[model samples]
Target: MTDFRLVIVSAGVSDPSSTRLLADRATQRVSSLAEKRGHTVTTTVIDLRELLPELPAAMSSQLLGPRFTRAVDALVRADGLVVASPVYKAGLSGLFTSFFQVIDNDLLIGKPVILGATAGTARHALVVDEEMRALFAYLRTLPVPTSLFASTEDWTDKALGARIERAGRELVLLMESGFARAVRDESWDSYQHSYGSAGGTELDIDLSSDMMRLATGGSLRDSDDDPFDPRRA
Candidate 1:
């Protein structure tokens, strides 16, 4: 059996928020699905509300403290993620966005993510696809095909449960198939730009490329006299 690590991030503010409820349901469903597929799943839930005080420091310094660092580490190491947040004024919670903002841009590359959101009105359901998907796309995370959005009315709707299960199954399948790891191992470097790479150096560039030759005005050559040539440097 394969071992899978799943991290659930709940960005709910209130003590008994619907956002957290959705996250819990999603996590449980995903865990159950993974178990059924003969994979052992270990889940960690991070409540962003608990780290509110530290957020200011994290945002200002652009650094994660010990507690938040541990949370981020869990996220980075996880095989899959369930991220849920409450919608406020047609946008995601600032706390939710702030928590993610401090994370390294490359940390979530190719990780499988299941996006979810809770709002008081059904009109905000699109927040899951429009805002949350956009955010995860920026991080280069592979969000599952199904996304869950829970509105006040959706709690009593049986369809909500179906959607949750569908999303969970998709995430479990992605995990079991090892697609995330394959993408990360094979194509991650191709997706990443040389600047600010994880190793703190640019990828090897071909000076013979038309772009490089044009940028150097065709003056750069392979000889040692060409100071701009990386080989000479």
Candidate 2:
């Protein structure tokens, strides 16, 4: 038996939309697969529509206020990730891109992700196949094959159900495969090297004794507030 967790995110702007369909199908696919493997599965859905948007600058470094930070924590610990979006202009939705761009550290790195998308016609279905896959690739997520996609025309049809079922089986194989490549088994800190990485070098990491990390609490350095543990000027 394995432990699996899935975070289905739909960064759709509309109130009643097909993006949720993509997310829901992905969730169902994972659920069915978990049953076959006897894996304990937990699911969390982050509907960007429901989340009040924080400033772009605040989340630009993977430190997404409180809500997204916790979401990151969960994704980092999960065995699986399935993310979907509504393609716009041959690419992912801007809302989804914003969510993706801000992450300094992709918590789901090395976890298997099922890339999915819903669009108006089959013409853009390939966007799901190409764009979302590349996005996950950039995040270093293991995007599984058999992407579950549906254009507006196919949602209610019987073939859609069959495709979803097929995707479910693929997801099962994905879970088994991802379990063997778990990143936690390796040192996470090693991945932190390289230019433009979060917080830069060790010197960039200011070790303040104050018990605050985010601007929401207070500024890291305030002329009025006494600063430092005396170890560094």
The TM-score of candidate 1 is 0.84
Task: Provide the lDDT at 215 for model 1.
Answer: 86
Q: Best-fitting candidate, measured by TM-score?
A: 1
| 78 Cα displacement, candidate 1 (Å) | 0.4
Give RMSD (Å) of candidate 1 vs. truth: 4.7
Alpha carbon lDDT of each predicted model: 0.86, 0.68
Per-structure clash totals for the candidates = 0, 0
Model 2 scores what on Cα lDDT?
0.68
Runs in model 2 lying further than 4 Å from the true structure: 59-63, 178-181, 187-233
Q: What is the C-alpha RMSD of each candidate to the true structure, in Å?
A: 4.7, 9.1
